[model samples]
Target: MNGLDLGVVGNGTIAGLVNSVGNYQWLCLPRFDGEPVFNKLLGGGGQFDIWMDGLVSRSQSYDTNTAILRTRLEAEDGAVMEIIDFAPRFETRGRVFRPASIVRRFHVVSGTPRIRITLTPETDWGDRKLPAVRGVNHIRFNDGELAFRVTTDAPVSYVLSGTSFLLEQDVSFILGADESLTDTVDVITLDWEERTRQYWTKWARSLAVPYEWQEAAIRAAITLKLCVFEETGGIVAALTTSIPEHEGSERNWDYRFCWIRDAYFTVTALNRLSAMGTLEHYMRWVRNIVAQSKGGHIQPVYGIGLESDLTEEYATHLPGFRHTGPVRRGNQAAEHIQHDVYGQVVLGVSQSFFDSRLISRPGIAEFRQLEPVGERAFAVHDTPDAGIWEFRTIAEVHTSSAIMCWAACDRLSKIAAHLGLPDRATYWSERAAIIHKTILEKAWNPKVGAFTASFGGDTLDASVLLMAEIGFVPASDERYVATVDAIDSTLREGNHVYRYKTEDDFGRPKTAFTACTFWHIDALYRVGRVEESREMFESVLSSRNHVGLLSEDFDPSTGDLWGNFPQTYCMVGIINSAALLSKPWSEVI
Candidate 1:
């Protein structure tokens, strides 16, 4: 597939991915799930790019503790230039100034250098490249319904003609709504840049981070926060979609929607770091989803705007990533009965009741709303449905899904008691006890010597490693320990782990799922295998790209990351593992 070596900058309302050479390869206007205006990441679509014409060497990184990207380009002639790109976000006049805009600053650091600007944007997912109407200091591109304007100090002729002009003074470009910029470009951009930097830095300062690998954990935390659409309190799985998990595997998926399974893991990690703002907002969203679920049947995923009918369809007009055909929008998995979501939804909201930092703690009404969720979990505790993997043609009584259901009931009992309801607590506790017994009896395999993927099946699934994670079983318990060993022997290839080895809808998976590897690390740490866990954690940390970001999966043989950019699950693994494995805070002092 085409490479996704881009850093993302977002302001909750909008996001963009800037390539190593300073091109916005993928960006959706208005919101994360909105139609793409720059579709070059999918191939053969319009893009917005700015780079030195004679650039030979380049390096890029996010400004420390912030999502702002800084790329330095050095030409062969010894001229140097730096590009500062960020979506302006900060507090102004007692409110957040998070507009649907991206501010870029071009600085000449050394010898005279010429630069080029390409502001071509395709309307309606690259169906056509719309033309721009230029003025003295700004240019406007419209698709009839919406208009995208670029106001810059650079000459319009030099930009349109792709002609390089001498870089005498620093230039700033503001890409936003179609409104005139009355203030000077440098003045407005500089102010926003400073405010954005301070905002992110202060946010990072509030995190209760581990001493070792603090930077990695911080970057992962910031990236996860960027995935949140603050307006709706929805968190996307990843920034860019349609990037395949493996080569020619047809495992490509659009991760722009929020999944209960993924969001649960994300909030769990943020909770460990004391980042309660995201958790509070996410719980608000989860409360709504739980209320909307009819008879406790929750979809695995939903649009950021909470749109339910995400029917999958292919955008065949544009070539797929790296020309892999059948680029898809919407998701078919939404239709499947992924039972793990009920448990995940409960787990995500349970934290609000205990976290004092949350603006509003869930009380009696929220507990009443969750009754249907526990009821459905108990009803389908042993029933068969699509597992977490979302196998299209096969259905089985997945052990992991059931375990999640058990967790749902287990947490419900505690939440009920927390609300001073003794009878309700006893009701949920009884259901949880039954589920606990059923999982131990039906899911455990005598010959395999551990819990299998499904009841009465011998296939091993690495997700079962979560037995210790979700408190389904104690790490010291022989059954849980034996299950970890079973997964280690069957699914682990070197330090990495695969979700499963069995052939499924597509075929055998060839790469290691990055998050599963982290699960293994956390499992080891939980079981007191500190030495081994540390070694494995270091190995997985090395798997990140140059800028310390991870995708969904990785090729163990080649150490090349594959799948969506800045995957929420994979990044959560980084934060969770670091928090679990890091030495005591007293030592750092």
Candidate 2:
């Protein structure tokens, strides 16, 4: 059965998800948001499968500190085989060589193992199957203008016919573009694998990870890096799309594009680990979005290539994940009036103005470009629109949006002071103060004994905990502590936290929003409940899939992962909580 326990292999340009038995369940070719060449994860008919006849046992894991995955399979007759999977990524000739390819190596460990290889690819969301054209040593699969070839050392006739053959020696399969290989399959595969391993280890050595939970932090960091589209620097929210938040909920939506709010949290978490490369690339993407906006409105989400019109549509042909219907392609939130985007735009780029380690630091001219964003934030701090949750029908002056708007002005004030512009600092400072005062007066609900989701509303929301997170309110503040207590009492279930109990267009949420639970844990630690916070953190960490990966939502009752796979928001939670809750290196070292 398909599950989220799958391991991810990527080279920043392309990615693939492999199950425990070494099946390519999901893979997007050409790019991250490109066509799904292998769509079996979403209940489609296309997948790359390697079946061990009479298999009895199997296990899968990643190479230490790297995205390379190895799966071991053993048959009843004592035949053993190991499969190594990865996307080729390494520095060569003064530039990073991250190709749009996946490399698979089949190694015989013990006896002669009979293996059957099935390579099927579908296009148009699994509605059309590509016709195969065979060659001397390779097979080409083409549909319309799209085409890719599998160059392998195995017999071409056996591969095309899905015939089971005796694997007496090691073999290699390079699934990539239609171009032919320059070298032999074994030579290039071995060389690329070694270089990729070295590149990942070197990158991992640079992370300033916390003392405790080092493994979890490293895995999450690498997964987050995989989400980045190296060509454009836009980080996707997750790899797969239309995986429902819960079973049969019809809450499925596409997460393959870059969301402004999600990108801010992603960059902030990576920044904590001193992974400044991702932040720099993402800042360039943000700057492009701002320039395209021309100091006007900004969408909450956009294509990684910066295409604006993300009109939502359903792929009627492909059944959703786990046979749940309604697999969606594009996101409808692009047209939403998500006013908080203004604040995210400013916050996402704020560090560039202050961090001297960056090669190109932002100056007065960059600040001038960002001022209009802050002005828009100040303009809509109290206006009604979709909150962070993106409610379709209900619109209110959401406290979370207001607080982010405040954050925009507050950070701009600090950036102005950093650039030695006292007058502009005062200007942004005064605007921040006004927004802060208004939130305190209107967002707090004395009737509920906490700050609610929206201004003048009595309902509790998990997002209000950001008051302490974004520095809207100090952790030591009485109201902030009280709000944390109120949310803890209301939204928490076991170790998981729900966004809210209120009903929306899709009815009530049935599972915990994985990232919100992390926020609750951080709030607990900030409020001097260290022991309880650590306990809750461990409990939530236990819910991660076998490979230490998380999705967007989790069911505390069943401990099953839901929503999109390898969610960037949930991975950011792992990085952030590990950083905050881990003991200092001085104590351990």
Taking all chains together, the TM-score of candidate 1 against the true structure is 0.98
Q: So what's the TM-score on candidate 2? A: 0.99
Give the Å shift of residue 61 in candidate 1.
1.0
User: Local distance difference test, per candidate?
Assistant: 0.88, 0.91
Clashing pairs in 1: none
- Native-vs-model 1 lDDT? 0.88
- Supply candidate 2's per-residue lDDT for 429: 99
- What's the distance in Å from true for residue 16, model 2? 1.2
lDDT of 1 at 165: 83
- For residues 1-589, could you state the per-residue lDDT of candidate 1 as single tens digits? 1376788898888889888988888888878877788888888467778767677999999999998999899998999999999998898899877888999999889998887788888876667887889889888988777688899988889987777788988889999999887698889999989999999999999999998889999999998998998887889999877888877989888889999899899988988899998888798788788778856589999988888889888777668778775577888888999888889989988888776777788789888888899999999989998999899998999999999999999999999888899999999999999999999999999899989999999999988889888888889998888888888888888899999999999999999999999999888888788899999999999888767889999888888788888899999999999998999889868
> Which pairs in model 2 have colliding backbones?
none
Provide the TM-score for each candidate, comma-separated.
0.98, 0.99
**How many steric clashes between backbone atoms does each model show?**
0, 0
lDDT of 2: 0.91
